[model samples]
Target: MLVVWDSTVNIYSCAVEGQEGLHSPVVCFQVKVTPQQFSAYKTLTCSTTCTLTGNPTYIWYKNGQIVTDNTSPYSVLPNAVDSYSCAVKGQEYLHSPAVCVQGQSCNRVTYTKRRICVLKGSTVDMSCTVGYYSTTSTFWFRSDKSTPEDLTRDPGYTGRVKHTGTYKGPFILRISGLIEEDSAEYRFTFKTYNFEWGHSFPGTTLSVTGLQVKVTPAAEGQKTLTCSTTCTLTDNPTYIWYKNGQNVQDNSSPMYSISSEDADSYYCAVKGHNGLSSPAVYGPKTTVSVSPSGEIVEGSSVTLTCSSDANPPVQSYTWWYKKNGGDYQSMTGPHHVFNQIQSSDSGEYYCEAQNEMGTDWSRTINMDVKYDPKSTSVSVSPSGEIVEGSSVTLTCSSDANPPVDKYTWYKKNGASLTGSEKTYNFTTISSEDRGEYYCGAENKYGHLNSSSVSVDVQYDPKNTSVSVSPSGDIVEGSSVTLTCSSDANPPVDKYTWYFQNKTFQNGFGQMYNISKFKSKDNGHYHCEAWNGRGSMNSTALMISLPGKQTSVMNAAVGIIVVVLVLILCLSGLMWFRKKASKSTSDTRHTADNGQGDSSPVYDNISGMAMNPTAAQTAATDDQDDVHYASVHFSRAKYEEVPLYSNVQLPQPQKQDEDFQYAAVKFNLPSAAPK
Candidate 1:
């Protein structure tokens, strides 16, 4: 009978029932996998060379490791390069020969080692195996940064890193002259036609360290010095020992025996790399000196040199300088030189000499450079618009090695001497203080004079007055020009002409012209001078007409006297005519009353020869009917004397009687009211 079991069992044996001391031999059979060159994700079947006892299970192995336990057929989605095998239950030790999955693309990477450690300054190689369907490119990068960067392009790895091998292959990354900063995880990445390998995969990690010599007590007053490293050196490199700057031993063993009483410095290095040796246990002696042992002057060449006595010689030198108790500034090199030294170059200086073993500092030295005064200048405070009555200050400045000891102030084309100090101040500035000024700066070596600067004092218009052209009298109908004058720092910008209390015209300059001077032009006239500072009105000047205007007034008065006499003569004549008419009316009334007839009577009167008594008698004699006479006068020429009057009588009481008329004459004044 046959029996089957799971593939987990490594060995198998059978015992027959009711058979005493009888057992089947423990057997092992080789498991064979069908389809040796199958594609990825293809199901595979496992069979044994010899038949098993019962229904048996199968165990699958990938890359020499157990993956799963199953019966007969096994299903897997495999990487194109991973190996696979199967085994029967209870016989895991005797499994089928491993077979790799072929064809059928998949993306995968496998590194040769997970972690590596090596000595600094030594070259290292990291390798990885890659699997892909169709690879386009592959590269190696460090995974230490937030983003993976190609090692070949890194500035720190320039000229020290290289990549080798094919796209889908056992790729190699070689780096020479490794440093402590090069310790990081490195990964290999490849790009296929459609996919890229994921960066999440943990890559190989590298740690770089320096070499050290450890001394321990040994037998018989001797000590064993061992060259030590943090990790085992690659390729099992030999060690080299140095004692007091001399090579002592070179061998595979890292241990060296030395006498305990020896007072010598010791160091170590790898056999092939002698330049990258360890630091010596002793310190170096250092000293600093300057060139030109005598007095240093400005613009002279000066240099500071640093010296050290070290086992491996100093690899780097740094010069430090301090001035006026300030912080030290560092400069690199064995010698610090100043091509043209200045007064500012004076300071205390020292140097530090360093090697791989230790560092040494030199004693401080003082440098002093003497020079004359230079860069002399004058500066004014309150830069713009120096107004009158405002305080102002003028400062003198210069650069000197021994410092300026004397300062003298001067004004161009001025007679008075100013103060002998760094600054010249004005308590209350005036227009008289405005002028070009300069200062003299003197030191122990020499003296310098600064360029002149102007102090323009701004003020309101002053001494403002108006002057008329032609000086004395302004004649009527003559052209006249009035000029406004004022004293100002910035000059007058505007001029305004005023007549009496009203502004007549605005002008940009001083002169105001009147084309025709008339009587109306005579008045109190003044002008206003204006500048940026202030405005001022000039004193009023009287503009009077000349003698030609006075004669015109006298002639006007004579014409007025003739007109008044003519008016008086005409008024007297009217009053005499009215009195004559009243006297005639009274006489007529008396005649009519004596007659008692009440009939109208006609009377004729002519020639002023008839006296008033005669005119009354004539009216009484005509008692039958008294009549009043009306007289008519005629006008005469001024040169002639004709004063005549005509009187006509009314119709007589008898209708057929002829009409009667009368003529009258009067005396007239001669030269009618000249």
Candidate 2:
């Protein structure tokens, strides 16, 4: 009977020359008499070939007893060397045996290994070593996570090449077309003829990488393409390209570059004797977003929004501020509010949006704010002098939020006046009302004072009168008094006395005494009373010395009579007397007194007796001594005498009127009439 090997055998099946089945009736070796078949000796190790056919199961036997499943072909148990036998499947078991016998030894030909390669677009013999294989497996992989599975074949390598060899010889895999994804480690597994157990060598990492098949712009058709591999190799790589996952013709080199219509998604694979790496993927999606910078008014609130799109979502938003030459600062929120705006608020602003992919910023913005001035000041019309009962206007204006609403008028006399800064009239003016008045303007905030104005009221004196005591002329030396009184609107502030045009006394009440009255003191006198309005004078009065006026009039009349008598006497004596006497023609006579006492010239004759010559001489003497009292003296009467006689004939000139000449004796004293 044929025996099976243990599970440790790596190469469970192998293609032998003319082998088909193991169950065909055949000879069986004697159990003990076969000399413990020492068919061959070999060593084993992990190899890429062991992975062929998805890690083929193997069985090992020692002295016809089963060994535990351990390594690939057999497990000698460390220093336990022994003869072993392996059983495997074959194509023609009727012509050959399914079992191969060998001995495990410390020094044996088991170290010798084989390589494998799969044809393009076909399942690969993963047991083949990469570099040792003359031809590599074409783009094949076992996708099983724990153990190897069925191999995938690349379509581009189909029908291009084939793999043929013993399971132990170089199991090279081959393909005509090269592709970028065809490069990788390939596994090859096989067994020796004498050593029933199969062994494996480390897998050979294949690098069938080639130049990237790239479709550049037609203008750049002459650009060079590059092909490289991480492993060092003696043979230069050959490149074949596929456009849009299809084979490309007329392109060969380690690097194939073209601007042809089939050059889109062009992929070139390297083919020497190794596998290829995966294609480098490069279709990165890129996008961009645009936004406008926001504008902010100085002293006002503003909002800034930033937007962007990327492969990943944006994480956070941030704002940045930029002045003419200042650094940037991050903002918590897009909106900024300032209770009180200042000049510094004016500048440019920007925002930035960030994500795991990248970051973007918005355009700069500008801000502007408006400003207003304060309230206008107020003033009064007539600033300093507002009269009593007179109206004044106070104007109020301002540059505040709201205009002045209403105005209040205040009187300085501790009284509240009317509303509205102006007044129309005072019913009547009185001195009782006069003081300072100021106005206050009202706004949203409070009150402000208008310029102050003052008022003054004037009046005239009333019920005025003047009195002089004793009801007589005021004498210079005697005591006399004057009093002035009045009832005035503002009160009689002062009393002034006037004598003639001179001012004497001034006060509310005055008593003027004439201590010594002189002639000069004799004149019209008056009193004046004054108030705030004006001063007024009293009716005139006279103050004088007693009896002074009458005495002066009498003395003037007496002097007038004495002047008239002296003028007439001197005229008569000079021219008429002597001439008249000489012209006496007919009547030259002596005259006598009629009465004994005296003689008077009268219309009738009065005679006096005396010696004629003596009398005549005496009369001449008397004329010489006495001055004529009046030119009205009657002509002296003379007696008729001889014309030649020297006679005094002064009377004879009057003889025509009186016709009586009288002579007086020189020695007699003159008599007077009552």
Candidate 3:
């Protein structure tokens, strides 16, 4: 605020910011003038303020005399060289500072602003104040204006410019649709009836321009990007920015800090630019990244990408791969893909991005591939025949990337039995546990199984046993076998069979065969297993009885003897009847029917005496063949049973030594001839 006391004209003017709102006054009150510098013969104005409100009416005094205006800016000209002061209408003792204006009388103007910049296609206000005793008309125009045309009514700026302040305005020129052509020093002009004035030397300078961006690298990880214009538009211009064409509303500074992750195109503009942005610019460098990253095993796929910020948009990308101590390989694409990657594909990889504007190379990236375990194997602790009641351990092994996290053990017979540790252990091995065994190794990727290994348990025989078929009361003529067996490792070496007499019955093998069995073969039997360790005998077995009977002979001899005895008894009875008949009747000579020359002898059994030792009937003649004779003897079983002897009487002494004969006949008694 400026105070110009012109004692010559007693005029006051102020060039100050408008105080539209009421201010809270402290202990004291202040007053000022607008357009403090004034030309001579201009209308003099005076104003006053105090520590009071309600739009208080003011009392004006010129050189200690009461002035008559209730409104502010009481216009008055100093008819004489005097001073002016102010006080409240009723409270005149509370006086204000006096302003004594004195200067050369002339039409004059002063711009409120010296220089400014505005955005294109926006509205702007240019203001100034003119102080002249008779300044009835005033206008604004640029410095090169012809005839100093009024900016508000000029033909070239007709629809775009107007006076915001009233017709008597300390001129405020409002212009819309500002353009670069509108940027220049603007002056204010005023006409005071006869004299005209133009003030251009201290006019306000206007500037209009678009935005631009620049990038620079500060440190390894940080980059600095600044947004600027062709020329400075305003004293303090706040900036707005965009990343990948998205507004960054939080950033209000022209410069921004960036890192490797911020690879997108960036642009900025001044505030109130209607979202206009500078041409996009890439920051410090490109960045390279691989997908499916981190400790991947072999046989998996991976993708790599190269990214950067560029002006003309990235046009081409090239991928480079290299192994340890090997040459780099190049492939043209934005991505490098590894499908079913293998160990030979492991290496360092990088990429380059190029455009019509520029080119950049990204930092190297490493891709590791993970896979399931392989080359799996299982091993036993002692590796050979296992002894019973001895400890054994089985270990599983495999190769994997991202090393295997789990191992499972299984014992295999016909089926699988599972356990959770890498090693399976047995405190004491038994015959029941001998079989094929294997293990499975696993990780996040997959699972693999080890090859199976078999175990052979060596043990001494226990609980030896022997068994016999067709055991008891077997039928004859059936074959039988006795088998010997035992529970043992390395098998039983020798099998021996024995009988009840404690003699070795069979020696060749485990079985004793008895084919076409006989009674002598039936007996108690047992077997034994003989080996290097020790020998064990089995429980006894037996074949008890014969099966069936076979043959029959002596009944035929008894039947033949019965028939001969009956014929002899009949002959004796007949002879007896014949003898009796002869005694009772006249002695009829027993005529021999065709008798032979040798007389047949008839024996008389009535006179026969019995000897306990021998009872005999003698044949009187050598031939008794013609006579039927029967001899009956009551015999004691204690005596010699009937003896028949052939006898020749003493007549034959001359022919031969007589064969002795004992044939005696009893003559039959004849009954009456009926």
lDDT of each: 0.70, 0.43, 0.61
Off by over 4 Å in 2: 1-378, 382-392, 396-399, 422-433, 450-497, 500-535, 538-674
lDDT of 3 by residue, 2-23 (tens): 2222211233333232542333
lDDT of 1 by residue, 28-47 (tens): 34333344355546566665
Candidate 2, run of 10 with poorest lDDT: 91-100
Q: Residue 68 error for model 3, in Å?
A: 89
Q: What is the C-alpha RMSD of each candidate to the true structure, in Å?
A: 32.5, 27.9, 27.2
What is the TM-score of candidate 2? 0.23
lDDT of 2 by residue, 21-50 (tens): 542232221111122235433343222211
Best by TM-score: 1
- So what's the TM-score on candidate 1? 0.39
